[model samples]
Target: MSRPFADGEGKVGTWVNEFKENQDVTYACLRPVQTTVLGKTAKVYLTPFSLNDYKLEQLKHSKSLSEKNSNYMMVCQKSEPKKTCEEILIPKMKVIPSKAESTLQKLSLGVHDESNKPGHKSPSAAAILSADMESSDEDITPGVDDFSGLSPYEKKRLKNISENAKFFASLQLSEVSARLREMIKKRQPPKSKRKKPKKRENEIGCRRSMRLLKVSPSGVSLPAPPTAPMLIEDENPLLPPGPLEMIPENADDNHELFKGFLQTWAEMNKTSSKNMEEELSSLKSYKANLNGMVISEDNVHKVTKGSISSVALHPSETRILVAAGSKLGQIGLWDLTQQHKEDGTYVFYVHSQPISCLYFSPANPAHLLSLSYDGTLRCGDFSRAVFDEVYRNESRSLSSFDFLAESAATLLVGHWDGALSLVDRRTPGTSYEKLISSSMTKIRTVHIHPVQRQYFITAGLRDTHVYDARYLNPRRSQPLVSVTEHTKSIASAYFSPVTGNRVVSTCADCKLRIFDSSCVSSQMPLLTSIRHNTITGRWLTRFQAVWDPKQEDCVIVGSMAHPRRVEVFHETGKGVHSLLGEGLGSVCSINAMHPTRYVLAGGNSSGRLHIFMKPGSY
Candidate 1:
């Protein structure tokens, strides 16, 4: 059988449009004929923007009338509504102009009844002739100096010689001249230095050497080589020689034996000198000691912070929310929202949690991602808390979880059983297990790539895995991408929304490293390396790092450092942004104030939860 659109005999009816143009509705002779050429009724022509302004105005008016009357085309739609996008666009036109109206066409052939100028290939015979003649008559004669001497003709030749010489000298090419007479004629006034081309690197170096070495650091003339002193090979380098002796190659003349002796002595004094300089600079600058922060901001306002498990803000970042779960399996969600109304009193009791994990669902406003300590992932409705239904999985432990805002059906969970499960939340009762890790090490963090929601990027105890969710729904096995960078367990891995190709990982070594998600290698180097301390068993898992919502170059990291520290890394993503001036102390979490930016709200081992708003000026 032939395809649906194929004409009989397999000859495509390319003139179907022409055939339709002449056809008219003939339902028992009730509908009349319609065609623009006939100039009867309201007829529109289909062309490259055949709608003149006047025709458009008429069509719009007709459309409005049809809408108000609900009689004309509306009846057909009601009978058998055309629901497809193509069907809806049939009566509309978003016309692209023809060649004649395009810029280049308009330029070549001027508008307003002018014959558009022919393009270069069509240059006129007359134009070509004129150009040829002009070049032939004026350019090839020998230098006029060939005719220099006495009569009127001779004087003219002499004047020409002087003018040509002056022109060449203006270009500074007179130095290339070998003839004495031409050189004499070229004696024009010297040109100003305003137009010199910039000097090349080697030329610049040569010039600097000639001008600088002639004077010493003390402003006294020095012999050639401007003093390359014999630099003592300091085992511990001393205060980099006095400011005056700090010149390049500061050592060449000292005897090797003496240089060695000086090096040994210099090493012992380096640390003391460094300490003195640091103390001096610290004394001069206004220092900020953020040793402690009030984590439970206005402790009275806190909803019993120690029991708090989850906190997130609206996509708009206008509010803050917190969820606390008690040992009694009770979960409580409070409006710890930062907007303190001077006049309004609190109404209380939103949602509570004996929560295992709180995942804010970005795609659906009415939903949230919830993990019960019982190994169940529930889709909690915003309106009430019984949850739509229980999604129980007993295969492995649901250790941690995260959600993707772009996909309406995905649920990503991390497991202590060493599996990263991608659950289908839409049909929660009949949960579809999209992916379960094949590895044996439990995953610590599960993050789904927003740009590719079908890909679950999970951090396993030993490696990071990127699973293509399409593998699950389609029953296809697209090999997962596993990156092993962290020496010990890979506790966390996050990809920035600004650029999907980059990701960061933190691990047991108390170090944070960045990787190009596209390439995972033993030689994968970090763009930024940060270490916490030397303490053993101090897993980096206790800390959290979040990308700055307002700037792609900045990342807010919470550290296990004593008195705690929130390191703000700027330009660490791409060298374009530099690190910031201050760090946060005792911060446990960085969450959105609203969906736009975040306030690092965290507490320390001291049982405090401080809310530090990102600096407004940043």
Candidate 2:
């Protein structure tokens, strides 16, 4: 029922006129009513257009369409193209001259200075050197023409000079010129001219005028002209020409010598001073009631299969993730917030032997790392859901490892055969450097300084070694510093996390040592040494003293005697706190602290993890 509309006109009504044809529907032109009546209004109508008027309207509409099309076409023709770099940048660039290239060209051309010209008399070597030394340019002339008629020795010297100039031109201009001047000065012969003392004119005049006094006829001397008194002692003395000998003299000994009495005064007071500090700490702990309360506990294995060797907490304590490794090489991860057996736990079986250490990456809290006695180190990234084998060895066993927090990419790994290696995560198969020694029976642990990332401390058979990571080469046989104070095997040694002002070590000799590490270049004074009971049962796990990240002055360690507890001691040999009573149900052998929060995690021999937060936090 619909027809397509035309562009020129739309017809909705039909009309038949004198010169027109009839149509089905034609459009009616509208006009306003000229007048209106009250109560009944007449319908409005429009006057039909004549032929002339219709023609005029059509011309006007056509004229407007032509003007718009012309304008559009003109604009399209006038547009400019986009400019490019070839037109703008090429003209602005200027050529720059290189100093090295110019110098090399000059040396190859064999140019000579004015001093070495054929017509001019050749100056002495010292004079030529002095003149050229004052100039900015370091170019040397070899006098090539003079060499044609000279002896072979002189020709050799000129050839050397030419070669030297070429060598200097090839190096960095600034540094090479300074070094060349120093070498030239050292090669020059010493000057033979000494500064002649100014002659005394008055004395010469006196001698000339009184020449007749020398032949005194009557044995009488003529009166000498009055002269000024010379200060013989005030004149500068001549320095010895050659090396001065340090001749020993038998001068009088005024030192007060102490007769054969052994210096036991210092040794006698050292023991008494240490005992006094221990008694003081005991009194402080009794009055302060220092104790920690546990908030929760989680079991690594449902039926307690094997002892738990290590435990680690994520850096971010928001959603706590407790990862513990067991003696049978099984690693269990639990979401502490969920606390369910099946739904909240994830287990990994990566090693064939027992696990030695477990830790979370400092750079990423979701990444976990584990080391085992089977000589394998592995990393698991939860974000990517992939496992990566970081390192492996067929002969040596990996015991423990620590990440360099500063680099966030390097790891220091210790082995059972007294070997240490620095492994980069990006290149896991090859080690960057390795250290080994015959005297080192076993490497127990390796700890990097918290503040100085370039240095690390290690505990071996009965000694501790400190090394600079930058200078550690495979062929180097010595460490930067060594500490040998324990009789039995040393368990672990660490620098203080805050300020790195002190070092604390736990040894199997039943002793804990504190040293002043504030200045490593000087002697490290032993601040205090305390008797600790480290003897557990034959098959028990060895206890290690770990520094609390929150407090630099206090350290926490497990107890092997009496009630089941973990004790904390001040660096000054004072007791800080004790986790005793029903709060801690079993003995804890391995522990770690939350980096930024007041929370602690511990593990026991029965495959369990114990968590303790601040008292008010629970």
Candidate 3:
């Protein structure tokens, strides 16, 4: 058997056989012709027939065929055709002139052409040589385009150069010498323009009146100062000048212009469905006494501590458990139902360092969680009458913690080292069930949304971050939202009990910022910020602004601007009330509201507890 192979030429073919191994394979050239095969037109190549040695011997051995029959050639098997040739490209060296070189050439040609003109005289060889061999010390001028993208500094330097040129052009030789001498002299420092300080608030109305004394030939008569425009009522052409409806004698009748007043009034009345509406309505009434709640001088209780760090009121109204934590690691418990005697209060030493935060478990009212700077988180169970250390680590200091409403046994604790750990009470032997590195700064406080237990917020030294507890994993590092509007350290961040849509954070920048957390934006929008005085006391602890559980619109924060007072602010940034008196002798930086009652308690730096009650409360 022989096989045929196609070479570079599509028409050339070579045949190889085992019997002719020593002989060179014969090749045939074929001509391509276009012909119709089946129903399609195609190109076909046919090889011409030719008899080789093998075919000649076969004819001689047969002895029956003529030499004409020996002319027959056998066709070999079909083989593939050679492919088309491809074009090849080779790179070559080429010279291209830059813009600067081309510009220089053009300039040189123009100069040469000008010199050769009939009206121009050609320079001497010496002068031409001198022009070609420029001095190395001479400065090179820049092109116009070079100035287009000059930096600000370069542009300023150019402007100064232009100004100096103008100045020199306007000055004489003597004046120039004098100016140069002056410039060479040591420059005197520029005088600072000091701004006059604004007058104090108390001096605004006490300014002395300036009198105008006129000397009318006798120097005795003084005319009144010139008067400006006075306010005068005029008739508006749009409104007919009829006798004004004084007080609307017919109370039920509505004017044509104010016909929608009744509809708006009805719509407003329909919205007064919640308790918040009633509270707001009460404040609007003339008889309403927001000041009915005040710290009485006789109601002050003193604790044996230097500074009160935190305070929390129990959720029971009948039997109030006012727990106050101090920097001396003492927990002062005062039973408000008992008499105001020294022996009536119970004090306990639970931590070695100052307390940071105190929270009463919502699931178990008898359980009180206390966090201290000593890196211990203990729960004082009233039902068991014992205090148990829930968690403590020597390396990581516990700053704050809150029970997750999603699971009562699950607690979210914030550490001083910027990690938020999820502690499962059921499995206490293991370390943190899940730890999340929320920030690079220490977490100051952690608060769970009162309504959405699955979501919690951690107030770090840098910013406040909101995370979903359900989606929290040890590997998860991102939060749902981050609020960084605070310019200083966030002392505390809390969600309103009535509605979790609003979050209030007290910042060390002396501001109480209210944010609308319910907004769909990535960052919650700040509703309002109230100006507060957080730096009044050097030794006093920072105040934490807490939302009144009774009214989400009201925020209560310790007032440092006043000698002794607590300020209450509405979400509109208005000061609604202030509990100020001589009883609060020092600055009160820690305050807590009675969860179920309309009572308030504040602790000062000296550990004096001040209590305020509503009307009729003894």
Candidate 4:
């Protein structure tokens, strides 16, 4: 019921009235309508006549249409055909100016005119309009401004744009913006030069402790006793201890001199023993009187060559004998009471590596024990004037050792490979009584409970554990209590010196933690965690927090803070005192307190010893 009409140009269109029911329709004559397209006016003819009539009209115009179709088909084929300019009918287009074009014309003319003025169009604008209408399409060129053709509105707009450009140029904002961009680029690193993350390989096997390996016992040998050189009256009195020398050929005369030295050391052991009642009373009444202590020039001395790794105070009340060990495997013994005699110091090369621990036997002050990373534990016997080898392990290096009972012969030693060995000096061979593997990677420190001698604690990596000596299994011993809140490697852990009711630890996370161990169980509650800097870099020894032997509630540790002082804090995280002096200008990484005296000693990385005591106590 519908029909489509096609014009002479072959554009088909639908007639809307074709769908009506009325059939009485009359044909209308052709007419033209005026319409504008693409800024050009043209006439379009529309006829609703019969299809036969439409075909007849198309036939009449076939000649002209064929020529136009041929040209269009050539263009579609991507080919150009030469034609005379008279045959090409170019449509007349109306010119409409844009704001940018008008403004550009004003800028080219370098003039400004008021748009609000009442008058006819400017003569210059009229001239440019006439020229644009008369110009041919082929004759027009781009980027050519008509300087003489600008209206008042365009001239005003051009004036405003020029003023803004001049203002910005005076401010020099473009140069400042360029410099800021350059600075930003320099501050940020380029993506191409950034470091790429390393790919981690899959671990193949589980880690096994070195103690589990089966190996033969290491050979143990005793070297000749080291002897000090005789001092001459004319020698420099402030000189350090001379190197050890071989005994003279006259062994008998040398033996006599050694015996006299032993006798004098015995006479210096004048510590009076107290009963349990008096000892408990004294401990309860002990207070840290830090204000009364002073560090003077006379109390400071260089005891060793390399950094001091460990320090121990002798328990003799009649004399002040401080012993220190260095990373260079040297042991220095300083006698403060005999400062005027031979410089009051003696240095001995006893080990081949760094000494990790030093302690004078409490049962007999004559025997001083020292452990070194060279896998050897030696005892300096003043009575015999010899360093006797007590234990050695060639398979693994020793890390820490402590006395297990009142008798100093029984010892508990920890290895770098997470193994614990029970050693008895009375035994003949280099073998241990019992060896047990632990659940740690490296045992950094070990401490036996003061009252409960059978209980001990070990610190390694990021964990600290307490174990009982009676239930240790040879394969894998279980811990009685474990403290795992440490976020970094634990430097050291120790029990209270008097009652063993609390444990204090120093961690590389810059925190000092204390645990209440009044009743040892699987869960030991954390008492306090104090924010203290414990990060001693590679060139210095690690900081360790140790308890005051006289006061069970107080703890002492070296500081990395300015003014180079040592800090003492109570168990509740309150600062008790900070020992500062002009003579102490370096970080004291290792510190120790006298067991029965009011004396404290700190050792620095430069091997210097600083002593703090009552001004006239020495």
TM-score against truth, every candidate: 0.43, 0.51, 0.53, 0.59
- Writing each residue's lDDT as its tens digit, candidate 4 over 1-618 gives 333433234334443234233322221100110112211211111112122211111112222222332332233233223432112222212122443343334333332232222331222321222112222222222212232343322333233334323333344554666688788889997578768877569746676544454332453334445798887764322212222242222234346554554455656544667532245334224443677788988889887887999999988776778989998778887778864533466677777678999998878887788988877788887766667778877668899999998878799999999999999977765535688888788898999999999899999999999999999988999999989999999999999988899999999999999999988765679999999999889998999999988777889999989989999988999888888999888999999998777799899999888998886776
What is candidate 3's lDDT per residue for 290-324, written digit by digit as tens?
56666666668876365899988776644545778
**Runs in model 2 with CA error above 4 Å?**
1-292, 296-304, 339-342, 428-439, 615-618
What candidate 3 gets wrong by more than 4 Å, as runs, is 1-289, 428-432, 615-618
Query: Model 1, 1-618: lDDT tens per residue?
Result: 111111112222232233235434421111111121122111222223211321111111111211221221232334343343233222221221232123212222222112122221222322211111111112223432232232222222122222222322343332333355465768866777788887787663434553556886676786775677787784322121111111112224444533332232223221112221122122112112222222333322333323444444333233344433322233333333324421111111222223445555555543545564446665545443225543555454466677644555656666676655666656635767655554545666667665666565667677776766555433333336666666877656777654545677767677767666544322334566656432323321155455554443445565445555456554343321111223434344333223343444443332233455434311
For model 4, give the 10-residue run with minimal summed lDDT.
26-35
Better of 3 and 4 by lDDT: 4
Candidate 4 regions exceeding 4 Å error are 1-263, 276-288, 429-431
Cα lDDT tens digits for candidate 2, 351-396: 6667888877765655678888888787765544445677777578
Give Cα-based local distance difference scores for all models: 0.41, 0.56, 0.59, 0.68
Instruction: Give candidate 1 regions above 4 Å deviation.
Output: 1-296, 299-301, 304-310, 323-332, 336-356, 428-430, 472-480, 518-525, 534-541, 571-594, 603-608, 614-618
Candidate that would win on TM-score: 4
- On lDDT, the candidate that comes out on top is 4
What is the number of residue pairs that collide in model 4?
0
Error (Å) of candidate 3 at residue 414 is 0.2
